[model samples]
Target: MALLDADARHPITLPDGTLYRDTVYLKNVIDHPRIKVGDFSYYTHSGKPEDTAAILAPYLGHSVRERLVIGKFVQIARGSYFITSSANHPMTGFTTYPFRIFKPETFGYKDLPVRDTVVEHDVWIGHNAAIMPGVRIGTGAIVAAASVVARDVPPYAVVGGNPASLIRMRYSDDIISELLSIAWWDWSLDKIEANLDALTLGDMEALRRA
Candidate 1:
């Protein structure tokens, strides 16, 4: 059997052979029009599989202008959720109160500028993290547990806190550039499996060779 199955909704299996229902491949489970998820991107949540999209991104409604773009191999821990553009109240007005929402006919703040929320490949978002609207979390970034990320996180950075700040970069700029150029995440599963040592170990030479 293959190590990974993209088609499986419940992808993880315990040592005793029971399917781990809490984790699901986001692409397979999510059917929202405004959200785009790549292969192997998984989210751990207690909600039903059918409600995975809503659970992960509660504010991203079907007709919303903004999008939630998540790339391949993203690891989203339990209790993490996205606050998309639709959730924002009108900040331009004198007050933040959404008076238009009281009436169904005039229920939208369409004039507000909307921006898409993007999470790039191989990003790890920890438990109870809140990703703010329009934030772009770069590839290989690590968002610490219980963080409220209001700003963009650079690639390979470790960020944490209420308004998440950069803790440190995982690698030097040169190495990060090299890895981004390599883009191992784009490789086929067979190729990736063959170069597991290079991927798991910090072996740049081996990775280049692979």
Candidate 2:
């Protein structure tokens, strides 16, 4: 039997064996031009599956310059959202108020700088976390519940709190580097399944041999 189905829209099954409709595979649910989600990345929410894109990144419009790139195996909890560069108001002027957006013809801050928001592979974002514009969350990072992430999160680090400070590193620098080199998330599903014990057990020797 397969461990998981990447194509399944509602991937989670409750203990009672009923499909958990609140959780959806982001790639299967989202069709936004500005958003890119890798296979097996899922987000939990109570809204309709079709509204996944809007709910995940509310400010990312079709015509917006910025992009939201999420990598494989990302687990996003409920109420977590990305505030992309498109949501930023013009800060070059004296006042931050968006006067041009009032009119349809000049309804944007086209001159403002924009940057893509990137969440790398194997990242686990906890509930109610808000990722600020253009923040690059590194691979294997953990964002704790209710965090207001305003800066980049290093790989394998556990971050929490309002400004999302690093709580601790999951592994030493060498181990993190080795894991990055291994890049288990890029492995084929069969290989990943075959090596599940090493991954789950945190046996570096076994993983290295695999």
Q: Please, what is the TM-score per model? A: 0.98, 0.98
Q: Which stretches of candidate 1 lie over 4 Å from their true place?
A: none
Best by lDDT: 1
Error of 1 at 114 (Å): 0.5
Q: What stretches of model 2 exceed 4 Å from their correct place? A: none
Residue 11 Cα positional deviation in candidate 2, in Å, after optimal superposition: 0.9
Clashes (N, CA, C under 3 Å) per candidate: 0, 0
Name the lDDT of candidate 2. 0.95
Write down the lDDT that model 1 would get.
Answer: 0.95
lDDT of 2 by residue, 114-160 (tens): 88999999999999999999999999999999999999999999999
Writing each residue's lDDT as its tens digit, candidate 1 over 78-176 gives 999999999999988699999998998888788889999999999999999999999999999999999999999999999999999999999999999
